[model samples]
Target chain A: MALDIPSPAALQLTASPAAVSAALTTTQVRVTSSFRGARIVLYGAVFDPSTTPSDVVVIVRGPDLPVRIARKTKVAGVWVNSRPVVFRGAPGFYMTASTRPLADIAGFGTLRRLGAGIDHLAINAPLEQHTETRYGVRDVVVSRLGADYLDWRRAVVRLKENAGLYDADDKGVTFVDKDLFKAEIDLPTEAPTGRYQAEIILFQDGQPVSRKVRSLTVEKAGIERTLYLFAHRSPWLYGLVSMALALGAGWAASLAFRRN
Target chain B: MDLYLPIAEVSVNAPLLVALGALVGFISGLFGIGGGFLMTPVLVLMGIPPAVAVASMANHVAASSTSSVISYTRKRAVDFRMGGVLAAGGVAGAIVGVEVFRWLRLMGQADLVVALSYLVFLGVIGGLMLVESLQSILRRRSGQPPKPRKDRRPPWLYSLPLKMRFPRSRLYISVIPPVLLGVFVGVLSAVMGVGGGFVLVPAMVYILRMPAGVVVGTSLFQIIITTSLTGVLQAGRNQTVDIVLATLLLVGGVLGAQLGAKASSRFRAEELRALLALIVLLVGLRMGLGLFFTPDEPFILMTGMG
Candidate 1:
């Protein structure tokens, strides 16, 4: 629960001299055995605020992990999973917060390129690679499955959303002062351990003027970390230990009963 | 309080998990059953991944059976020789079962297969037990002596090769039948994350014609080895066993089992069997209903399969 804010790195000055920088309340999150969930605040300031009104968009994304979406179909009398679609680089956690609606802040092309909105988010998958130019970038996401692929994509989002992993809020980013703003992102207990990225973008005139990226680490700590490493690193030994523990406990219980 | 399971990677209520373990353990002790069939499904219902629930329950079974085996050993009820043969066959079955489990997981049918297995086995076993127990209860109520069970083994059992003499059970049976029985039970243990005692005990009494005195002990002896082996393989190969979760269950199970054992003397055997049968049938029916009913969410999402 302790917050350790690391000094924010200055971003490159854009042509307009407007630079947006952000820092998380904690640069690292240690998920202990008692970890339920955590709320992290990404606070930053936009320097040299222009006379023209601008919007701030904050995105916090977890590490890419492969996910499979299996659709169930009736087989005989029981329903069973049939076709499965695998997304190779689905973010384990994704939260997007903006001062205003992303569509109103920037054009579709800009948001798609930035991957700012939930709908505009691009998840990588193994698909036929005939690319079409869209939003000044080759869109590899649109594949032979075509419109059908969107169903699978939507399934992933819906499931993640239900799990409280993927989240979006049009007005989650609040400006506390003339240039100081903060965005809160909630990390669920089921969030995967890995590196997370927080990106703060300043949009003006329907275009992103300045962007800054900050990295955060979420990892198992204390007994949780040790056990996770032991289980994965030397599973055979761990298994033996598990057997031994069971045997010992069973023997102890029997002895206790006998003594009584 | 919520505690995160390292391997399962999910936060769950610590007290709730312990209570679940205690409940399963108490039932197992009261009925002299392994309780894996009950434990696995309940864990899954509590949102533990199916694979983790199954693998971890194997470890729990190992502990519970060990407790029973120790008591049986003190009373000279266990047939170590018979248990060894069964264990050998069980180990072989477990090896094959784990591989099949892995393949099912890859095909994304592990959950379906597990549910079906539980539904079928629990249903058949529960129904048979209910009918048999009810008949016995009625006979006792009418002051009629129960019909004596036929002690004769099937002719086919004697016709098998590699016959062995088991002085403990005072039976001369073919080694092949016992070994094959062991193998079948072992596969069940591995795939279903059960102790397989429910099946093993009945098979030994009727098919092998083992003495009723040695049946429970011999089954427990086999269960300990098979479930321990299954636990190890599951942990090493599938990495599905959650040691922390296993430990919590053990703490509650050991204590609950001792209390249940103490309480068992007060209950009538026939009545207990009938109650156990009813509980089993209810769990089985619940699982079966899940299969037949349409899910609100037709899509199942899995992460970290890459």
Candidate 2:
């Protein structure tokens, strides 16, 4: 057993598996009328036996969408939304889980580069300008308003976390053995319907060795899907249908109660 | 059990929603008010988006009002001519009101304005009703004749042109007053996210001098048209109406309204008014305190903005 321990150089020299093979408890999250939330289990086995001095980090990113946050200020004895910050390309849901604490596993720069944390997400401010030159101007503005923009960005993260749409857990993943590990992601009821990407990164000595990406679909099913489609596709008809239903219900209720 | 609201994009407890509807419907039936003001705030508190809350309340009000209107009509209490005139003006006022609402929203002061307005209106109305009802109750208990309210129309109302006769109300008043009154209620309904029945009932009793028997049915008729218009416009413009939510509320609301109507006959008029006044005061005070109290979170987020 002592002789089986390879030297550090030999360990580095050996060819590792290109990527980890992973499977999800369920690939598709079907949002039925009674859906509250779901706990998805992701299990994977590191192919290389020599991948001991490594960590596994799983990142689940939901679809990107624009989000707006407003800060309330006391004005004339009342609270009102005064400053609004709009964020573009913000994920509707985001979660990161790691076998060990993210800070202990990797440096800030590495985590940022990998976009493995909520703070490291690539979100942009929607600076209103149409012209191509606006990018340069916006960059200058952002630099000048760096502190304010950072506060707004942090607020966005805080809001999403509060809403259960963004989360991170250092101990969310556990290694069953040297070769197998599992991560659990809890999807909240507010999870938007869209394509989600689950990325599993294998890290060796705070460096990425291999990575695997899996596509997951979160979709409204059954009547939920039909109603959503009807509202979005033909809003006028949807409105009329809603009105007719309301009227019919009212009439029926009146008739039913008349006898009593 | 939990049910998902498609437009609101939130899952809520089904029984809780139904109970909320029942409570508000009972209040509406007892008071002859649409209960939108109460319902909207409650929905917002339940984590539903404000826009969705307001739009769906309109749908619920339309249904509830329709049911009440049918009952009132069967009893020959509705003055159709008066309702028609008010509804016509309401339509035009609602158009103008929508524009005003948009303008206020652009300035980001809509929420403040709505809250302040509700506080003021509810406070004043509730206070007045409380005092009058209490006095009436005391007078009746003491075996004294209740003082009669002055029924004389204002001079300005008499001088106005386009006079019309409301045979059921037994009034020959200027149509302009009712139309203008309708416009005022319409604007309030649009801006306040209510059916304006609380305001309408008082206005009809005092300003238009409509008989108490005719007020509930007539106001309900107007509410049906006005709130239905609001529901359609909200759906068309904002796409905020959640039919699933509205349906749940309507189911509970219709049944609750019937039961409340039955219960109303059992209570004395003054006692009913006093109870309603207490509820209004409580709601108003809660809203007023919200304005002064520091919020747990000074920052709020509005998602899905493009």
- lDDT winner: 1
Model 2 agreement with the true structure over A15-70: per-residue lDDT tens digits: 56545778889999999898898999999988765536778899888988778667
Clashing pairs in 2: none
Cα lDDT tens digits for candidate 1, A1-260: 21111223332234787778888898898999989989999899988645777789998888877787788889999989865567765688888999998888988876776667778766746753467788888664457556667777788889999999999999999999989998998999988788888888888778777887888999999999998889899999999999899989988999988998
* C-alpha lDDT score of every prediction, in listed order: 0.83, 0.82
Docking class of 2: medium
The sequence of per-residue lDDT tens digits that candidate 2 reaches over residues B244-272 is: 99999988887777777778899998999
For candidate 2, give the lDDT: 0.82
Q: Candidate 2 chain A, which ten residues in sequence have the lowest lDDT sum? A: A1-10
RMSD of 2: 5.7
Q: List residue ranges in candidate 2 displaced over 4 A.
A: A1-18, A128-146, B102-108
TM-score of model 2 relative to the true fold?
A: 0.92
lDDT of 1 by residue, B132-205 (tens): 89999999999999879897779998887888888888877788988888898888888888998778876787
True contacts kept of 2: 0.68
Q: For model 1, what TM-score does chain A reach?
A: 0.86
Error of 1 at A130 (Å): 8.0
